[model samples]
Target: MKPAEAYILNQPEPFKSMLMHLQILIEGTFPDVDLQFKWKIPFYYLNDKPFCYLNPSKKKGYVDVVFWVSAHLTKYNEYLISENRKVVKSLRYFKLEDINEEILLTVLDEAHQLKDKGFYKRS
Candidate 1:
């Protein structure tokens, strides 16, 4: 198994399941994308660069779907970032009930598109 998958599988509950779902979603969206385990999270890679990441927020009790370098892209539809600043510059946070199938698909597809177009970069 890949390091990313192993990391997600080893995490505690809620996080593990949530990350698993995201992993599956990302893979299904871009079958050729690469996954990297960095910064204690699973960072999805495309064209050998950081694309997005997944982490479980213990306090918030929800999974964080992070776009490592998302400061430049504009938000569309319901896809949005957690904060208004450039801090991490990517969408974060996902609740089990808030996880709509269509929404997830749209985000993943946009992520891949952003990565493919070199719109974002690893910091």
Candidate 2:
């Protein structure tokens, strides 16, 4: 397990379970995507560039998938945009059981396409 994964597992209760679920869902959707710890949180990267981060705030009681490199997403994906500057451009907020599999897969597919087109920096 990655340091990030272990960290998530160490979290208590809802956070641990929710974090693990999100990680599994994302990993399942993009089995080839790379992941690491960034800013003390789980960050998912495509081709080494910033793709998205999983925010599991135990205090705030929410989890969001944040895409900082939102510049690569077209208007077609604007529906996922977040107005909060603290968050990445394309943000998807979800509760413990609210994860939409299809939407997640679509976003993963888009990220992969962007990575393949050399839209991201390589590690």
User: Could you say which candidate leads in lDDT?
Assistant: 2
Query: Candidate 2, residues 1-123: lDDT per residue as tens digits?
Result: 898988898888777777788788788878767789989999987766777888876776767777765666664475575665654564444466666666766776776677667777565
Candidate 1 off by > 4 Å: 75-79, 84-94, 120-123
TM-score of each: 0.78, 0.80
Q: Which candidate is the best by TM-score?
A: 2
In the range 1-123, model 1's lDDT, one tens digit per residue, is 878888888988767777787788788878877888788778877777777777677887777677655554454534666566554544454455566667666666766677556564444
State in Å the error of residue 24, model 2.
1.3
- Candidate 1 TM-score, true structure as reference: 0.78
